[model samples]
Target chain A: MKTLTVDLGDRSYPIHIGSGLLGQSALWTPHIRGRQVMIVTNETVAPLYLAKVREALTAYQVDEVILPDGEQYKNLDTLNLIFDALLSRTHNRTTTLVALGGGVVGDMCGFAAACYQRGVDFIQVPTTLLSQVDSSVGGKTGVNHALGKNMIGAFYQPNVVLIDTDTLQTLPDRELSAGMAEVIKYGLIADAGFYQWVSDNISGLMRGEADLLATAIERSCACKADVVGQDETETGIRAILNFGHTFGHAIEAHQGYGVWLHGEAVGTGMLMAADYGYRTGKITRAELNGLRVMLEQAGLPIVAPADMGCEDFLSRMRIDKKVMDGRIRLVLLEKIGEAFVTTDIDTNALNQTLCAGAQLGY
Target chain B: MKTLTVDLGDRSYPIHIGSGLLGQSALWTPHIRGRQVMIVTNETVAPLYLAKVREALTAYQVDEVILPDGEQYKNLDTLNLIFDALLSRTHNRTTTLVALGGGVVGDMCGFAAACYQRGVDFIQVPTTLLSQVDSSVGGKTGVNHALGKNMIGAFYQPNVVLIDTDTLQTLPDRELSAGMAEVIKYGLIADAGFYQWVSDNISGLMRGEADLLATAIERSCACKADVVGQDETETGIRAILNFGHTFGHAIEAHQGYGVWLHGEAVGTGMLMAADYGYRTGKITRAELNGLRVMLEQAGLPIVAPADMGCEDFLSRMRIDKKVMDGRIRLVLLEKIGEAFVTTDIDTNALNQTLCAGAQLGY
Candidate 1:
């Protein structure tokens, strides 16, 4: 197992990347503070991993709350179930919640800990590639609102993130591509060399080469942890982390959450942002082409839905977290691996990008 | 207006105590950071104070979410209404929410501010004496859950607490007595001098004498703010501020919230706690009589509800925020104006106090 720490003083925690962490008692026991343990998982993941996790928590008084699976179920209504189970069982402030699934489970459970009794300790045992590389590393936990994605939430960090790469063996191919989009986002916003490494080894990641996937997950989390450490709350530089998310969240909202996986929308959103940056003359067409090739190389979407237009996109994007002072701020690429947030953009250029692949009726 | 600061370093804010603060835009404008304003109030307070608050924010774009009045409405469902309004209006992170009512409105709105897009700035425009003296002074904010009162929440502080003492004139007589419960609590737990002052000036306050009421609000807030500054998250010293809350919250929970006003429940809960303190040999019998006489003098209940018993109290108390590691912690009066938290009390003493008012089937 290789360990990487997200350097947040006092709240700092480790991300353990390994082949089989669920069966490892040491990784799970230290973070479990109280005698009572509430394991929050989903229907899709419980049958496969519940017994193993329960076995590991043998000494503690363990309880399980299994939710229906999917991103669409990620909302305030579903978030209530975790609260219900914890309260009905009379879980106190000292109780520690273990999120034992992918991003949705991790996000929902982490948020429940943040709000339950003001805040409680929680462990993120992220099972999928996307969560292992992205959501599991940062303390950004929240549920999606109908008008926008992740609108109601908190930036509550977990005690430790136990990433079991072995769980990736069961992830669907489409989900893998979604997770890759975020993995690629880290490289696109910060690391040029890492971006090149991912581009060169795209095939290995798709084929699920154990060593190659482990390297990618470790590198991605390191990049995220560095950025998050500099800015815990997005008052300034942290806003750049939402490079493709502004457009991505809009796509998720209008397309109806879960209709398109978060990663797919983000991958497509990156393409849209790359095109917008290129049209605005900040990014060269060649750099935009390189991003398109890489996204395509990883089986990611390079186009917005063929039906969405400039107005539809604008209406949804305007409500995203990226918008500030009524101006829609977006993470636009300056070069292949360099990005900047700018609200001052030419409307015609934005329209041109919006009308590129979709029917805009201009 | 007499101003006192909560002194929480960078998160520190001032509490403005005076008559007719609602019409004072100068008090309202400095804390409001953004152009977008959301006023979260209730139906009862809407006709009374909403228009006055909106008038004060006329320069900025304002929106409102008026909930049904009462404690029964302080839950996740009502919290959703605030989110719906904010989302529907596309209120950004820069949006400032103004909680323009009593403790219910302030608590719900403050929790809303804490959760809305991770968080946003909010001001507490407390319209009730209970809110001005107790809930509004501290940064504790949350909505109620079915299993427990304030079972789900965040310890997010408001940017400012705007206390308009003039609004107390419109408050009903019962509500005024309910507010006194907490006023009496301040004396019983931490301020002997203040307790005697209230005892001597009880009629003036009951009659809503402007000077007497103002003095009581400021002193109560000062006591609360001092404790909160030392322990913001209720780790140790802050728990003492909960004096009668272990039993108070249980009474509130079992009485079907909104039935017995929070202060009334606390008043009765304080009585039960006083008896327990006496039985445990922590306080003199004379001290216990002083508390009983003062509560009766304030028109507050000196006993628990006739329907509850040791078992009923135990079951509900187990789910309170004070419960840790399955042990129920209670705040006992070491002396008038002083209290401490302990979980090592004898069960018979607790039962004796609980069975005093309620006819238990023993």
Candidate 2:
């Protein structure tokens, strides 16, 4: 078992990573402040791990809401289901909501907690690799809007994030690879050694080797925690956390939310950013190739959709949350393991990068 | 103009009170960091005050979304319109939202700002006296659910609260009385002198005497600011701020929202709390009568809806946000100008208070 603390002063919480931690009451009970516990999960995860989580929360008045699975369900209409269940059960301000699925579930539940009665306590019990390595650590919780992804949300931190690695064993291979994009992102934005380590162990991590996967999760969260602790609300350096997210969000928005998994879009988005870096002479060809090879080895997408043109990417990117003063700010790589946000894009160069399409990162 | 600051460290903002603060660019422009400004107003307020607000923001890229007026529209479904307008306008994280109506507009816009791209800057331009005295000073921003009022929202503070008292001249007689319910409340919970002053000058204030209304607004905001600064999230002393809200929410939820204005319900609720205080020997009968007379003189309801019985009140109050565990915690008056929250209610006494019907606060 490995534990990493996201130090956020009063909002600080621990990320507990290990196998079979779901049924362990001692691991989560201390975080459950109120007797009324509502477990928010989805249809996919409910049948698998809901009972284990329910078992751990027996001492409290437990209620559960099982939402339809998928990124497409991550919107305000779907988010209201959790609120309905809470109101029907008379869950009060003291009630603590437990998010028990992947990123979609965690994001909705955390946001529900934030808005329910003007904010309540919520604990994250992430059941997927993408969530464990990414969503669970950051306090960014919200639902997606039809116009854009995560356009409606809050930065409400969780009481604790209990990551039971045993649940990842049930994740599909595609999902596993998608999670790797964020894991690799940690190395790209902040840690060169961690980046090299992720590249070296990419295949094993994809294969779900417990120790390697656990190590990757720990390192990724630690790197993210360090960044978030300094810039909790993304005023400055924290924007780098969305390194590939601008282009990734464009892909997600263009292709429809569920068409490409978030990590998959981000995986390809990182490659595009890397290609832009290479074209701008910020990184050597070998550095760009190194990132491309890692993403490919992890079985992630390396390019934007062939049909998505410069306008498609440009139009979607304009509405992204990262845009400021009508200028789209993107986190582009200066080098592998180093990224910076800039609105100083040359139109011709950006058009070339966008028009790169299938040839991106080749 | 009288300026009072709600000292919520870092999130602190000023409450500016006087005539014609709406067109003063110096007051609100300093608060708007971004060039894109979205003004959210209602149909009622737009025809009157929207043009003035727009004229003040001529320097920025201004957009406006006019929602249907009334508290009946204060729900999640209606809240979505703001999101739609924001996304369609390509408003980003830096965009500042100006709430230019009453409480409904302020609450929805503030919650929209809080959730839009995980928070943004917003200014409160409260037109109604109800909003100017209460909602603008407190950061309690949210929409209502069918099951309860204010069931979904956030404690998002504004950049500043500009109380243009001039707008109150156009306010209806009913709305003016409704606003007085909150003004009277400030005296009931924290200021005996203010309470007496409101009673002695109720008719003049209700008749739209500018000086008296301005003084009332200042005192109400100052009292609210003091309480909010002490307990922002209602962990302790701040619960007193909701002295009548628990019972008030029950009435509002039972009668259907907007059927009775929020302040009217709260006025009756305050009477009920005072009745409870009298029955419990916490205050004299004379004190209870004083509250009833003031509510009556102010043209506010002094009794709960006749159809609403003990069961209806209990059933709805049980789901209120103030409930902790299965116990319903209520803010009951200890005296004319002091209140306390308690979960220790004797069934018989509570039933007597609930069954008071038309005799309530008499």
Candidate 3:
């Protein structure tokens, strides 16, 4: 078992990673501040882990709200379902909300907690690799609006994130590959050694080796926690954590949410950022190809949607949260292990990258 | 102009009060950190003051979203209009949202700013006296849900609260009186001297005497600012700020929102709290009568809805944000000038107060 604490001062919480931690009441008992608990999960996840969570919280009054699964349902209207459940059940300020699914459930439940009666205690029980390594650690929680992905949300932290690795054993291979996109992101953004480690053990991770997968989750969470602790609200250096998100959000919004898994879009988006980096002389072509190789090996997409044009990417990217005034600010890689945010993108290079088809990493 | 700062550490901002300050760009220019501003107003207010505000913001790229006026529209559906407008216009994180109407506009816009791209800069230009004295000064922002009022919202503060007393001149008689309910409340909960003053000059304030009204607005904001500064999230002393809100929210929710203006409902709620206080021997009958006289003179409701049974009040009050562990917590007057929150309630006394009807003060 490995535990990483996201040190957000008073708002800080721990990310507990291990096997069979879900049914262990001791692991999450202290974090449940109130006598009442509401477990927010999705249809797909409910049938799998809901009962385990309910049985664990047998001491307290428990309620459950099951939402439809998928990123497309991550919007205000769907988010309201959680609100309806809370209000109808008369959940008070002291009542704690437990998010019991992947990123979509975690985001919506965390946000619901943030707004329910002007804020309440929230806990995250992430059941997906993408969620455990990424969404669960950072306090960024929200729903996606039609105009853009994650356009409506809040930076609300959870009391604790319970990551039961046993759940991943049930995750589909495609989903595991999707989760690896973010694991690979941790390396490409800040850690060269971790990147090299992932490169060396990519196949082991893909094969569902418990030890290797656990280590990757720990390292990813630690990196995310470190970044979030420094810039809880993403004012300065924290923006670096969004290395491929700008480009990825463009892909997600243009392709329609749920079409490409968030990790898949980010996977392709990172390649796009690296491509531009290589063209701008920020990173060597060899480093760019290395990232592309890792993404492809992880069973992730290495190319943007064929239907999307330069204008689609450009227009969608402009609506990104990183955009200031009318200028688009993007997170670009200086090399395989370092990334930086810049507003100085050359249109010609960007256009070529957008126009690049299968020739991207060549 | 009188300036009072809501000292919330780095999140602190000022409340500016005076007549004709809306045209003075100098007051709000420093607070706007962005190049773009979106003024959110309602149909009732736009035709009257939108042009003046737009003319003042000529130097900046400004956009306006006009919503239907009234408290019934203060729900998640109307809030989506602001989100839709912001996204369609491609408003970025740096964009400042200016709430240009009353409490409804300020609450929705402030909440919109809080959730738009996980928070943005917000400024309040409160036009109604109800907004100027109460909503604008508090960082409380949210929309109503079907089951409850303010069931979905955030404690997001604005950069500045621009209160133009001049706008009150155009306010209807009932609306001006509704605003007085909150003004009277500040006096009832925190300032005996202010209560006495309101008693002495109630008619003049109702008649729209500029100096008296301005002083009343400043004093009310100062009281609210002090309470907010002490407890930003209402964990402790701040809940006292919702003196009549628990009872008030029940009225708003049961009667259908916008039926009784928020302050009017609060007016009756305060009297109910006082009635309970009197029945519990917490205050003298004379003090309760004094509060009733002031509310009556101010043209505010002195009784709860006759159609509402004690069960209705109890059921609705349990859903209040103040409730904890199925126990209803309420803010009650220890005396005319002091208020405290307690979950300790005698069912017999509470039922008596709820069933008092027009005989409340007696």
Classified by CAPRI criteria, candidate 2 counts as high
Q: For each candidate, give the TM-score of chain B.
A: 0.97, 0.98, 0.98
Error of 3 at A112 (Å): 0.6
Candidate 1 per-residue lDDT, tens place, B172-272, comes to: 98888888888888888899999999989998899889899999999999999999999999998988878888888888888899988998888888888
Off by over 4 Å in 1: A358-362, B358-362
TM-score, predicted candidate 3 vs. hidden true structure: 0.99
Docking level for model 1: high
- All candidates: CA RMSD (Å): 2.1, 1.2, 1.1
- State which candidate has the highest DockQ: 2
Model 2: colliding residue pairs: none
For B97-140, candidate 3 gives per-residue lDDT tens digits of 99999999999999999999999999999999999999998799
All candidates in order of TM-score, best leading: 3, 2, 1
lDDT of each: 0.87, 0.90, 0.90
* Candidate rank order under DockQ: 2, 3, 1
Cα error of candidate 1 at position A77, Å? 0.9
Q: Give the DockQ (2 decimals) of all models.
A: 0.85, 0.89, 0.88
lDDT of 2 by residue, B225-247 (tens): 99999888878999888878888
